[model samples]
Target: DEMAQIREFIEIAGEYGLAYEYINCALERHPYKISGKAAIKLLEVGLLMGFKSGRENDKRFDRR
Candidate 1:
């Protein structure tokens, strides 16, 4: 069920979207400067977890 929803979302939104906007404003308010890898791990955006591999055992959805 969850996988189906994710596929539908990707089909609709594609692989790109408003990834930046007022990002500087957000950074200005925040003290920590996160790396690209670290940012993907953040669950608020869920970019990492949101993408799942066919194998449920693999948490990062890495392709083998």
Candidate 2:
């Protein structure tokens, strides 16, 4: 079932440091060998951390 979902091409995002934070969090938490909601939380923490970092850097970046 999961494989079936990935066949549709999954996408992820984070703040300015997405790749670094995301991979580090996944590796630190051993997100592999797991599935579903718990896995989502592990990844969510990383993204939120990255978002926080970016937010701290520039509080008004909405001009875009």
For lDDT, the strongest prediction is 2
**Full-model lDDT for every candidate:** 0.45, 0.47
For residues 1-64, write the lDDT of model 2, one tens digit per residue: 4333333333432233554344445555675676678668855864565433244445453233
Look at candidate 2 and give me any clashing residue pairs: none
How well does each candidate superpose onto the true structure, as a TM-score? Answer: 0.23, 0.28
Per residue, candidate 1 scores C-alpha lDDT tens digits across 10-39 of 576554222221232345466868898866
**How many clashes in candidate 2?**
0
Where is model 2 more than 4 Å wrong at Cα? 1-32, 51-64
Report backbone clashes per prediction.
Answer: 0, 0
